[model samples]
Target: MTTGFETDRISRRKAIWREIPAGIWALGFVSLLMDVSSEMIHALLPVYMVTVLGTSALTVGMIEGVAEATASITKMFSGALSDWLGKRKLLAALGYGLAAFTKPIFPLAPSVGWLIAARFIDRIGKGIRGAPRDALVADISPAHLRGASFGLRQSLDTIGAFFGPLLAIALMWLTANQFSAVFWIAVIPGFLSFVLILVAVREPKRPEGLRRIRMPFSRSELGRLGAAYWWVVAVAAVFTLARFSEAFLVLRAQSIGLPLMLVPAVLVIMNIAYAISAYPVGVLSDRIDRVTVLIVGLFLLLAADLLLAFAPGAIGLVLGVVLWGLHMGFTQGLLATLIADAAPAELRGTAFGMFNLVTGLALLIASVTAGALWDATGPQGTFLAGAVFTLLTLIGLLPVQTRLGKREAS
Candidate 1:
């Protein structure tokens, strides 16, 4: 049982960042491009649905829910298939390429239905690609620098997130308000990400004995790591339910009178804040207990929910949004790493796949539930709902702490 920390070997090139293992670096570049493309469209999606598309909050929520659900099943199946096939890069490329291929279609959308169609297709691709790509990283990154490896990848991925909205803002200024062009332009990054995965990232051949291993799932053979993994999965599902989506934040900001033109700036601020914090916190989590970092993120969200519920104005909302970004910085990559650490080597894909499936499904429920609460009680109600979940999650952590502590000791 080699622990994650015990595998800390690093090549000189990786230490210098000259060629940080392609498996990990490839994700950074791929995400950089994908985020730039996604944020360009997603940041504006809520506005488009509510204003231009003439949709209700519930409709918007449903669209998001559907997209998330699509991503979940796709991720789970794709991850399982990747492990089954003993191949990774090609599938990941297919997923990214599919997402990229859909980029140009957004500009072609003239109706909410059309946009949802595009979203579904894109999320399908994301779902297909995500878990395998994550498993690939866990497979390649040596144990000791796992934090730095994941952090570097996350920071680079967020670099696109940081730049994507700003680029969209510039396009908006240049076009004097043509969102279609921004969307159309987003296709380029997706294509490039596809290329990178095709050419740069290499998939290790499937593990030996894979042929003898049971296909699909074998619940009977869950293994030594299964108990801790399921506990963490439960926690992640709770976290996902509480986290909801930033689309709500955008909607909330608009409700309080944030000018449409300035919305990009809000996204920029949040992403920049997220980018700055991801790497440092990821590395720190690698050093300490990953769960501790996750708890910090969960707490931040709890506070952000309260802030959203009671805050007075744009400043308060901005602060709340920044807190949300910080929360992501702490948890997102760390969760990926933690699951990898907790899975059997061969079934790591299934572990991440199941984890994503549960969380993604939870996100759909959470998003729709938030919308319903908003309709029933208002944005304040939505915030309060999130707060209640977060508090409950916080309380739930106690028993988990006791178990992990006992495990570590014995």
Candidate 2:
């Protein structure tokens, strides 16, 4: 059944896969395990907060926004430290270790305050490790395979994201909907993730002529990142305003009469689509214009927002979730690839840190606004607002799309 062209294509794809560095693969798996641990708790946390703790939708949004913003803020400093020390793995290990230790708190927390503190501490760990880990991937990857590398890591991480929810769903069923019991089981994978990264990931040696920077965030050092890099950050911040936290997706599903036990299925479906599309889209970007791919992603999100806003019944909800996942697959890794392409190697950590900082802050604003809209005009308003933002982002991309292509070609 296989034609010669098909055979050639398959062989080439395998060759590209083999070309990716072992260190990138190790990093991907490390992300996989951590995401598995994190998602298991997160998949249930929103519903638990709303139902068990009597928290409002607005409150949930605030908590999620604060948690992510904290992580992003921390990334800036941790990223700079990694650059200054010229050591990424140690900081990465510390971050993962801190997150691992925080896992028990989720099950043990007796009040909303305690749960908030746990989430806060957990995000700090995520923040500490995020930039350095991303920078490490960029360092290990071949320039030609950069898109594929980030895509592969994202794909692996999303696999864990879906798996975590599936595990939570199963445990909920077996334990008779015992939320604490499921949280307790989630702790094991978090520790495993920490251990895997500590042992398996090896930092590449610094290049012979590379100089260590004492102040990565100083005016002069930041200037080195250039207009092209800053443009990527600006466009990314606009794009982030369209996409809020995944917690809203859970709420949407629950609003439609999905049973509590099956709520995690929302993430399961979205992540499957995300996991399936991410690597292929990444590989596609390697061959085409990345900005074009990103534009396509924006369209997908627009469609998803429209569907989530106006579509009828369970089928509509599932379809919208799938499109949302696909959009994430198309855009997320490519954005990282863009950053890696634009920035000089020496400042990659700082570049990623700044990018995360901007996007993270944007996300906080979006989440809080979405929550307020949910309270005022219902879920429809929240999603329609997302659609409007997505359109604005599409318009914003017009001026930069050609420039992004030119920059990547250079």
- List the candidates' TM-scores in order: 0.85, 0.91
lDDT of 1 by residue, 164-226 (tens): 878887887899877778778888888888888888887776657754336746665455446
Worst 10 residues of 2 by lDDT: 399-408
List where candidate 1 sits over 4 angstroms from the true fold.
1-20, 43-64, 106-117, 205-212, 221-225, 399-410
- Local distance difference test scores for all models: 0.80, 0.90
Error of 1 at 63 (Å): 4.5
Per-prediction CA RMSD (Å):
5.5, 2.5
Per-residue lDDT of model 2, residues 2-43, tens digit only: 999999999999998999999889889988888889988998
Q: Using alpha carbons, what is the TM-score of model 1?
A: 0.85
